[model samples]
Target: MVADAPLRLSDTNACVDAVIERVGKNITLGLPLGLGKPVRFVNALYQRAKDDPSINLHIVTALSLLAPRGSSSLEKRFMGPFAERLYGRIPELAYARDVSANRLPDNVKVSEFFFKAGSFLNNVDQQRNYVCTNYTHAVRDLMALGVNVIGQMIAPGDGSGQVSLSSNPDLSLDLLPLMREREAEGTPVAVIGELNENLPFMGQHAAIAETSFDVLLEHQPSDYPLFSAPQMAVSPADHLIGFYASTLLRDGGTLQVGIGSLGAALVHSTIMRHKQNDDWNAVFDRLRVADRFPVATEDGGTEPFREGLYGCSEMMVDGFYYLLDAGVLTRVVYDHAGLQTLINQGDISQQVSLDTLDVLRREKLIDSPMRARDVRWLTRFGIFRDTVEFKGGRLRVGEQSLDADLDNADSREAIRTLALGDRLTGGVVMHGGFYVGPESFYQALRDLSDEDRQRICMTSVNYINHLYDHAFGTQRLKAAQRVHSRFINSAMMYTLSGAAVSDGLDDGRVVSGVGGQYNFVAMAHELPDARSILTLRSTRQSGGEAVSNIVFSYGHCTIPRHLRDIVVTEYGIADLRGQPDEQVYLRLIRIADSRFQQDLLKQAQKAGKVAPDFTLPADWCNNTPDAVRQAVTRTGDEELFPAFPFGRDFTDEELTLGKALQTLKAATSTRRGKLVTLWQALREKDEDGRYAALLQRMGLENPRGLKARLDRRLVIHGLRKLDTPSDTGSKET
Candidate 1:
C-alpha cells in the first residue's frame, strides 16, 4: 500500500487534483451533511465545475431543511418557544417559506441528492429524489447516480494533514469499509482531508494509510462552536412531568436523554437534589463507598454500585457530562482493551485522590472547595479508605496515598496518610470540549484518560440499530422496550380503532408542520414493551378564552386513537394503552382538562366513541390545574419557580425582544399584514449607526458593518428595547 508514497501530507487543492487524476471525470462526494463543512464543499464543487465540467458532485444524506426567511425573532432557530412562536405563525406572517433555499448550486442539482429512508433523525416524506435504506445505502445510491470518484471532506488532525476516513468515527455509520470494498472492486480515488494537526485520535477500524486515499488534503479543522444549553421557562406542568420521569430513573440505570428544555431542566433538577435533600446526598455517598472491608461475595467482593451508572448512548451531550461531574459515574474502557486489565488497573478500582480533587476544586471544576463537613460525610460513607503508603509520608484519603514500605511503622503511617488521600474525584471517562452551562459535569468526564474513556458507556450511536434488532430478541433490556413506545405517537393511530383525532375547524390552511408524532405511534404497534405516552397541555389560553388541548377532535391529528398510551395530566394518569374504544374515551375524559371535561363527555357521546353510561369520575374532577399549581407553588422567590431552571445568561433587553417577537408571532397567526410590516421595518432599519454607537459605548473602534441584516437582529432588538426603559423594558406600542 505504501509503494511510492510521498513523505509528507498534500494540500487541499493538490489532494483534489490527485483524486481526479486517479479516478477520471465523474465524482461523488459523501459529505457529513451539516451547515458546517458541507456548505463549503458544495460551494467549492460548484466553483470547480465552472472550470472542469467533467467532475460531478452528488450529495446523499439528510440535512435540516428549515422554513424560509428564518425567524423574525432575534435568537437562533433551534431555541424552543421563541422558534415555535416565530415559525408557528407562518400563514399570517408569511414566514412559512422554506428556510433552506431550494435552489441548488449551479453545478450540483437536487436530482442527484440521495436520501435515507426510515431515518429516525429526519423527515422521510420531505426527503425526495433517490432514497435508500441507510447512510451506507445512500452512499451506494450515489455511485448509481454516475459518481466515479468519492470525496470525503472531514477535517483531519491538527487541522492541517490528510486524515484517514476511518479515523473520524461516528455512531451513525462508517463508510471506510464500504469504501475499501469499492476499492477492491474497480472503483478507486478516495479523497481524504486532514485538517487538524494538534492531537489526533486513533481507534476502531479507523485506520487508512497514505496509499488508501489517492488525494490526502491538508487543511485546518473547522472549529464548530459547542451548542450551549438553551434557556427556557420550565412551566409548572413541564416540571411535574420532569419530576415524574425522574422517578422512572433507577439509581444505577443508564439514561438516554433527548435535547432541549426537558433534558436541560432534568440535569438542573438532579444537581438540585444534592443541595436540597440530605437523603439524596447520603445515597450518593454510600454508593461511592469503597470496598475496604471487602465482602466475600462471589461478585468479585466489589461494591455493586461502586462503579456507578455508565452512560451508554449516541449523544455525548450535557447530561452525560453532568453525571460525570457529580461523581455518580466514573471509569471508561475502550472496546479493544483487554478484559483482564479491568481487574488490575489501579485507577479503575480507586477513587480520585484528594490532591486531584483539590486541584479541580481550585479550578472551579467543582462547585466549591471541600470543607471539613464534606470530608466527614465522605469518611462516614464507604468511598474514603484509611490505608497508607510510605513514599509520600502522611497522606489523607481525600489527598494522596503513600508508596512507603508497609512492613515498617513509619511506612504504615505513610500508607494510612495515603488512604486518607483517597477522596471522591471522578476517574476515567472520554470527554472533550468546553461546556459552560453544565461545566462541572463536563470537567469530571474529561478528567479521564483515553484507555479509561471506553468504560464510560457514554456513546450509544450503535444503539439505534441495536435496539431495533433487540425489540424482537428474547431478553429485553430497558433500551429495547422503549422502541415500542414510539408506536403510540403515530399520526393515524386512532384510525385503527375506528376513531380520528382532528379538529373540525379547517377554514383555511394552518401553519402546522407534520412533526414526528405519527412515526412514534406507528412504531408503538410494531414493538412489544413499547407504548406512547401522549401528553396534552390540558387547556390553552388564547384571546382571553381558555380552550381545551383535548378538543372533540383536532383539526389535524398528530396521533390517532389506537396508538394512545398512558395519557397523564394534573388530574391523574389515564391508562388508555391497549384499551377498547369505549374504555379509551372514558379514561381519556377522566384525566382531561377540568374546564372542558363536561363538554368533551357530551361530544364523545355525540360521536359514539364513548359508552353512553361513562361519567366523569368525581375524585379525578377535584384536581384542577389551579389546585395542582397552588400545591407546587412557592410563596416567594421567583428563582424557586423552576422557570429557566437550567437558567439563561441573556440580558433583560434580549428577554424583552424574545417575548415581543413571540407576541408578534401569535398576533400574525390570527391577523395578517401586522407582522409582515413590523418585520420589514425591522429588516430595513440601518443597523450600521447602531453598531457604531455600540462600539463607541464600549470604547472600541467600530468594525465595518459587514454582518448580514439577519445577524444583527439579536443585538439590534436588544438595543432597541433599552431606548424605551420601562420596568419590564416594554417596547413602543
Candidate 2:
C-alpha cells in the first residue's frame, strides 16, 4: 500500500518544533516579532535557546531589543514615572543606569542590523508591527553571523527538500540573493504558514506554494489583535503644520506618509480642513509650486482632483481610514471592476484625468438614482453625511456638491468644490501585518459594507517585506493623489545630503532591519505630483544630557541627503530633496529646534556648507522652546495637548509614567547628576513590575538595557549628548 502522505500539515506547536529541529545547526534564525505566531514562535525559540546550552541563538527581529538608540514615543510612555517609582524606592540602584548601556550581555547579541535606506526610514519595525522587513533581515543576519539555524514561515508544497523564503516581495530585490545563498548552502529550513488560503492572490513575486517550505504549519491564521490609532485632539500646532503641508499638495499630487502619532495628528487636521471648508488648495495654486497636480495625464483620465486632489500611499493606517470617511478617495475612473472592486482590493493604480468631473459623475462620484439604495447603505459604514442629497444625477452635500448637469463653467467650479470636498474625505489605504492595541477603530472600519470596507485594506497575509511595499506604495502613490498629502509619525528619518536614510544607531551599531523607507522615497521622487515627508523630534535625552537630532552628520544615515525630500519638526519644514549643499544645510538649520539652530549654523559654516553671509530667516529664527510650547497650545490648558494627538492606547498609569518620564528626561538633560537624584527621590516598590509594564508597552518584552544603550549612542552621534556617571547609576537601570 502507498504510504501516508509524507507532508501532512503540522499542528502549531508541532510545526514550531519541526522548524526548531530543522534549525538544529543553522547559524542564524530570523522571524517577525509581534503578537502572532511569528513573534510567539521566535520568542519560543529564543527561550528554548536560553535553556539549551548548545544552541547559540541570535535574533534579528525588531523587538524592544532593537528599538532606536534614543527616546522614542513608545519608550517615553513606558519609562517615565514607572522609572521614577521603581528607582525612587531603591535609591542605591539609581546609579546603575549605565549598566544597561551599549555593551551587550555575554549571552545575547545582534551582530548586524539590516534595513532599506530611505528618506523617511520607512520600514517594518517602525509601524505598529511589521514582520517582513524585520524577519527578512533577521534571518539574513543570522546566516551571515554563522548561525546554524534559521526559521521562518512559507507555504507548504513550495519546498523542494530545500526551503524557500517566500511571501510578499519587498522593494529590496536583493533579498533573493540571500535566499539563494541560504538554500544553496543547504542551511535554510522553510517554515510555512497556511494562512494564505483565504487571502487574495496578489500578482508577481508575491505568489508562493506550499511546497517551498521545509515544514508546513497548518494552524489557523493567527488572530492578530486589532489596534486602533486614537482619535487625537487636533491642536492648532498640528493644524498649522498639516495646513502648510496641504498647501504643497496640488489636486493630483502623490504622497507617502510614515506611521504613528504625528501621522494620526495630520490626518485629523486634514479631516478638519474638509469639515470647515478651508481654502488651503488656493494657497498651493498661488505658490505655483513645482510638480503641480495633473488634471489629465497621458494616462488619459482626468483626476477628479483636476477640480481638487486625491491621495495614494502605503500606510493603511488611521490616516487612510480618515480619508475614506471624508470622501477624498472617490474613484472617477477604474479599469477592471470599477472603483468598488479596486477599493475592496485595497489599492488603485492610474494617472490623471482631464474630463474627470463629467466622467466621475457618469461613473457615480455623485449618487445615481439607480444606486440610491447603495448610497443609503453607505451611511451605515459612515460614508455619507446627513446632508447628502441627489439632484439631476449628482451628489450634493452641505455648501458644496458634484453635479453632472451643470454647464461647462458651472461644472468646472462645482467640480473643484466637489473634488476638494472629496479630497478632504477620501484617500487612505490602511494595512498592517500585525496590529496590536485597541480594536474599536478597526472594528469601525470592518463594520462597513464590503464597498465601504473595500475602501480600507487590512493586509493580514503576505511576506514580511511585500506587505510593507504594498502598504508604502499604496500610501505614497494612491493615498497621496487622493488626499493631497499624507502623514507618517512613526520613527527615525535620517537625512544625509543625498541618497540614504538609516534608522536606529547605537555605539556604531544598527538595532533594527531596514524596512520600507527606500521604496517610499524612491517612489516619492518618481511621483511628480507626490512628496514623501519625514517627521522627527528635535532632540533626545541620553544618560543625563539632551542631544540634538539635527547633526552635521550621522555616523550612519538611514536616508541620504539626496533622497531627503522634506523633513519636519515642531519648528518648521526643511525641504532638502534636490537642494545644493548650502541650501540643504540652510533649510535643515531653519527647522532644527531653536536651542540648537545657532550651533547647527555654526557647524554648517565651519564645514563650508553654508556661506558666512547666509543669515537665518527672521521668521524662522523666532522659534524657541517656549515658542514651540505656545505653538502647540490651543484654547485649552497646556496639559490638554496629548503627546499623542489621536488617543492614548496605554493605561492611565502608563500615560502618567510617560509624562513623568518626559519631565525626568528634561531634568536629566539640563542638570548634571539630576537623573540619579531624581531616580532616588522617585523610586518606589514593584520595580520589576514597572520594568515589566514598560516591556509590555514595547509589546511585552523583558527589561533590558540594549534599547536604552542604543538610544544613548544615537544621541551622542546626532547631538553629542552623553550621560553623566551619577545619572548612569539610576535605580531603574
Whose lDDT is greatest here? 2
Residues 494-531 of candidate 2: C-alpha lDDT, one tens digit per residue: 44353333455644334444555655555556643345
The deviation in Å at residue 151 for candidate 2 is 6.7
Give lDDT for model 1: 0.40
Q: In terms of TM-score, how similar is model 2 to the real structure?
A: 0.56
Candidate 1 lDDT, tens digit per residue, 157-255?
Answer: 333333423212331133444565666786764644433332123322232344445444444454222212345566665554443333323333334
Model 2 misplacement above 4 A:
1-13, 20-29, 33-36, 43-60, 63-188, 194-243, 279-315, 329-438, 441-448, 453-507, 511-513, 541-547, 606-608, 634-645, 651-654, 668-733
The lDDT values for all models are: 0.40, 0.43
Best by TM-score: 1
